[model samples]
Target: MTFTLGPRAISAGYQLAAFDQIGSTNAEALARARDGERGPKWFVTTEQTAGRGRRQRAWVMPRGNLASSILEVMDVSPAVAATLGFAAGLSLESALQKLAVEANMRRAEPLKFALKWPNDVLAERQKLTGILLEAEAVAGNRLAVVVGIGTNVVAAPEGTPTPATSLAALGVHVGAEELFKGLAEAWVEFRGIWDNGRGFAGIRKAWLDRAFGVGEPVAIRTGTATIEGTFDTIDETGCLIVRTAEGKRMPITAGEVYFGTAASLGAT
Candidate 1:
């Protein structure tokens, strides 16, 4: 009754690049690729002066947190490039499980962590990490993309909307080097699913399997429009399929999915 958890340690084909502090990894990766240099993996740190989230929001990246970007060469289309964040989310969850940090688990089940639509990794209903992925067209058939991720490994800063948790806070202690190494290894498997032109079907399945609040009531915030509906499921493109009050099922490709009770939703 034994099983292997970790794959044989192999180079993730990443050349480690570090910075004392930087504005952003996606910026650096795109800049490096444009400058005719190979987009190597960068372990960015030092103040994270201008870290950001999806949609240009300021990301609160305190020192001692996990913030880095992996630049990969791909032949993926623009549409698929848009879904790369899903692949990275899947990779992050797998690595955290290995480190004995269950992001997706309940007291009855085993997986408490879940992925928010578009680009967020949640832990205990709080955000443990977030990702920002950007793809740029290269000269020929190649697309240079940077998958930047930030994890609160040590602690989180104050005044944030959501409560943030770290691996250490979850009772799983490890250093930055080990955490990054295992994460890179998991990304290799994710790259396979992406490179095969499979779109987000595989990633969607993996995410749904461990996702929180699926088939439940949810409230979504879409900036202009706020909707409350039953969380039916996610579509092939990783969009949420929710049932609205008017007996219509809607597709939510972009927006925040939040869980709520049917009683509360009835008031909406």
Candidate 2:
């Protein structure tokens, strides 16, 4: 099946650059931005040979999986641009939920999809998708930002920090092409609400509604130390708010989060 942009995305003036294979969609998107391609366009593929997750961790996408990145050139600061990731999470979660319903699997036994703080989508507490945001300065003080989303459609990597799952493993049985179609349209809706950071308040609220592990015990590994606390909420600037044991509300800028049993075990 060929990957294509949804009608809504096309109508919204969003473009697509689908590939049969690629080293990294995010890398390609950024390169285009450097070459003066100022676009709200998507670079997508089914197989990614050299993808990097947060902290330069390898994230190789198998042939059956989906690797997609969207490029946007904006005048917002990188700090404000970072918040766009929240909208990406919301968009992907919305797409997955829509696909689940279309497959008629949710009517009998619903499959829960939740956003993991920062950039991940969890299906039943198992990592199903990983999102990475990268940006570089372009001409006229604008930033070319690429938001990459990779999902396990038919295959999940083994022995990860957090156990991973796939749509096929969960019995959804959808193709990567179909998933991308839904994701493209969903992006249009959520990106509209985001409105380039001016509407982040609404995005934050909706994201929390579909967030995983709020009010649950959490341990965050932030290189220097492990901060253990209960997951509270995300702040206005998109920082993770944790309620420490000492009754202090601590905001974490970035960290590896562990919850439930993993939190108790001090898992990184």
What is each predicted model's overall lDDT from 0 to 1? 0.71, 0.93
Off by over 4 Å in 1: 1-12, 38-42, 101-111, 261-268
Q: Give the distance in Å from residue 23's predicted Cα in candidate 2 to where it truly belongs.
A: 0.3
For TM-score, the strongest prediction is: 2
Clashing pairs in 1: 103-113, 104-111, 104-112, 104-113, 105-110, 105-111, 105-112, 105-113
> 182-255, model 1: which lDDT tens digit per residue?
77778778866766347467777787787767777788878877788788887776577889878799998777
lDDT tens readout by residue for model 2, 126-228: 9999999999999999999999999999999998888899999888889999999999999999999999899999999999999999999999999989898
Error of 2 at 51 (Å): 0.7
In candidate 1, position 23 carries an lDDT of 83
Find the 10 residues in a row with the least total lDDT in model 2.
Answer: 101-110
TM per candidate comes to 0.84, 0.97
Segments in model 2 whose C-alpha atoms lie over 4 Å from true places:
102-108, 264-268
Query: The CA-based lDDT of model 2 is what?
Result: 0.93
